[model samples]
Target: MAPVVHGFDWPDRFVVGTIGDPGERTFYLQAKAGREVVSVALEKQQSAQLAAGIDHILDELRAQDGNPYHVPADMPEELRDDEPLDGPVLEQFRVGTMTLGWDPSTSQIVIEAMPITTIDDEDEDGLDEEPEPDELLVVRIPVGSARAFALRTREVVAAGRPLCPLCGSPMSPDRPHECRLPDDQP
Candidate 1:
């Protein structure tokens, strides 16, 4: 049996994809309610670390009925029109020393976050301040989906997949020149 770090009703409005390989790691988070998607990429090791971090985040998200973090409405506008928001937030969630490992037996991603101290920036003088901390959340996602997402992201980043360089449309690798219109034919 796969160890379920945490489980919650999969948000009707949320879908996240992650693609990782030995050299690159990419995560894609999409919010159906908001019609937003965020993508982030890191080095191979960093990506693994991020996957680990998300284990905790998924746990937290599942424990709560709604998203706990506050994202400004205007913040969505700041993202590139083509970029998704979920990927970036997931990437940022891992701040301190964190790592992610995959369990082949169960097709699960395991994330671990180490204990570390961070300063609360609420004070005016920028001094370290402590506040009542909330319980940490853990998230669990199926390993198959995670692997597919990671691979898709890597393909996009490597330019190995056929896609419109100008408009970012997924295209055929063998037909790179097919995009030209009849009038624009050379």
Candidate 2:
């Protein structure tokens, strides 16, 4: 069957949120355009990387001579969205691959998330290949919204289990953490 692309050119909302506790949380990438809403499950690392990637791209754009895009180094206050995910967070798919890019024409950040695909044996070229996913999510937001999205994502990711000061490992609130300290230390 042909692939289904859920495209949101100028979404009203786009953010990353979690549904569970700190130690056992499920991260989701959500996009809403008018009444339509789509959510996709993803790893915490992917969420962090997405935010970092957006920030990196915006920073590079802001550094350009004349700064045509008017990219902001910080998240705009007016665009900040701290509310919880809208509607029931029903995940459409688990994202396996994510791509980010800047659309110069619209001055927007483009984010695409594709579902996980199983790879079969190596092909004639000795390269493991995988089939295309049936569903995908494509969202585009302006520079300010992009910054806000990144900011909110960072906050959501950091809201997880606190790190252990001694071992620098995550400490669960519900259970004790086994801190693996350096041999040189106590």
Candidate 3:
């Protein structure tokens, strides 16, 4: 069966947002174009890495002598988006793998996310061929929007629960945290 693709080219909005409390948040990557919207659930680390990866790609592009892509050194202030996720944030899928690339023709950043899947023998039909993902979310955003997306992602990630001062682990907001120290440290 072919996978369903929800693709957005230069979407009107793209951002990372979370639901629930800091320690128990569910991160989502949402993109909207006109009335069409797609949201994919992903781990917090995945969100952070995606943002960093985008920045790295943009930085490499800007390093070119002529700066042909016109990649911005910093996110455009006017492009900063601090808004929450669009209401009724329904997740289309849970992301299993994410890939990023540059679209030279359009000078845009391409992001493809594949949904998580479990293959059963019955489902595989005893065939040696690999199975296709149930669905995919593909989004292409211009350089400026890409920069802003990365910036907002970082902020959303940082908004999580504060780390324990002693152990450097996330601390629960509603309860006390028992910090573990090394035996040698007393």
Candidate 4:
């Protein structure tokens, strides 16, 4: 199936689809120009081989345009080889969410970026340049480990919850809770 386009403003594109069974799992991304879509689907044991292939393609794209994070001078001797580099290091610099989709026609996985907000703090020294209010600086990472990426993303989101663990009740963020769980304890 063709990807569903989620609505986004100018300079941003929406990518939506599924990695395996479309009904079982769906992913989405809001990407801007020049951002890399790292296919993390390959991180799954069942998808590892495909991930390697996707990584190879992404590496070629990065080599042609020059990856923002990897300066030729900074590359380690071992990573300078033809094989694609691993995914963990790349995850550190990502700016927003990433989703994975598989194209059955080509058997290739599509990785896309999601929109994110940015806050810029004024520099006390006044030497640092300040970004415009509407401007967003984003980094794109192409991940070969989709399962790992998804799990990590979920964990981060879940950590922010104001919810009762025992009863699965929604807790008020503004009010104190009496539950014994550390997250609920007040």
Candidate 5:
């Protein structure tokens, strides 16, 4: 299929949000430009990783410029928790590859989400294989928006199952997680 590119050079809003209860949440990367909106489904990890990439890039930029970088206090507090995915939506492809970058020249946050691949690692010729052509969603938003995305993603991720104090694994909300505490830790 032809790649469905939503290359928003500077979208009004590009953010990651989720739907569903805590344990069953579904993540989405939505890009809105005026009235044109494109929403794609992705794993929660993908959203978290993209936000981390944005944070890392912003940190480097601030360090180099010796300027304080911050997410606007007015940024959305919640990621529209449990909002139904925007759709009449004929299609909802799973995301396989997610790329994030900060365009130094434009100072804009760039995000790319490629559809989940079904290709096998080895080819008939025993060479590495790549996924066939597929739709790619690309979005670019301001630095402040990007910063807010990261901060809010972190917060949302933390709101899920609590972590085990000993092993740091996620503890079931209704039950305790079996922790392999270190010998030193009583």
Candidate 6:
């Protein structure tokens, strides 16, 4: 199937938010222009990666002059219109491969998200047909807005359950975290 592309040249609002409680939360990366909104579901690692990439790029750009970034304007250069998690919630599908890059001509951060596929056995049905390509969600956001998005994304992704001191895995919500230690250890 052809990609269901949601391309936004300059979105009015874009953010990453989560629904549900701390232990059973669902994270969503949403971009909106007027009333049109495109939502994509992604793994927590994806969220962390995206944020880190944006931050790394920003740092690289600033390190050229070895000074903190500062822009002067009557109004803020970046769009501070952060959409709350509970505001205008929309349906989102799981994402598979996600790509992030910069467009020099437009000076926009490009993010592409492809749909995730489920693993299944087709031998039972005796059909050997290959699966169709998944659709993608493409978002082109300005550098300023991209920075804001990165900040918010880091917050949301880190808001999950705390990690275990010994194991490094997220602590179980219901039971005490059991460290994955060696068999010889007590």
The regions of model 3 sitting more than 4 angstroms off are: 123-130, 183-186
Candidate 1: where is the Cα deviation over 4 Å? 1-45, 48-83, 86-94, 102-107, 112-116, 119-137, 153-186
| lDDT of candidates 1 onward, in order | 0.39, 0.92, 0.93, 0.34, 0.70, 0.74
What would the per-residue lDDT of candidate 6 be over residues 11-83, giving only the tens digit for each residue? 8777888888777887788888887888877778888999888777666655656443431111243455445
RMSD of each: 16.8, 2.0, 1.8, 18.2, 3.9, 5.0
Q: For candidate 3, lDDT tens digit of each residue in 54-75?
A: 9999999999999999999999
Looking at model 2, which ten-residue stretch has the lowest summed lDDT? 120-129
In the range 1-186, model 2's lDDT, one tens digit per residue, is 989999999899999999988889999999999999999999999999999999999999999999999998888899999999986998899999999998999999999999998655554553544577899899999999999999999999999989899988888777878877799986
Give per-model TM-scores: 0.30, 0.92, 0.93, 0.26, 0.77, 0.76
Q: Model 1 lDDT vs. the true structure?
A: 0.39
lDDT of 4 by residue, 1-186 (tens): 332232222222212112333123323222333353332221222223333444454454447555642323222333222222222222212224334444434323365433333544554554454322222222223232322233334433333335677656556666666755557555
* Backbone clash total, candidate 6: 0
Model 6 segments more than 4 A misplaced? 64-82, 86-88, 118-134, 180-186
lDDT of 4 at 5: 38
- Stretches off by above 4 angstroms in model 4 are 1-29, 32-101, 104-107, 110-145, 177-186
The residue pairs in collision within model 3 are none
Candidate 2 segments whose C-alpha is farther than 4 A from its true place: 120-127
Report model 3's TM-score to 2 decimal places.
0.93
For candidate 3, give the lDDT of residue 24.
Answer: 86
- Whichever of 1 and 4 has more TM-score, that candidate is 1
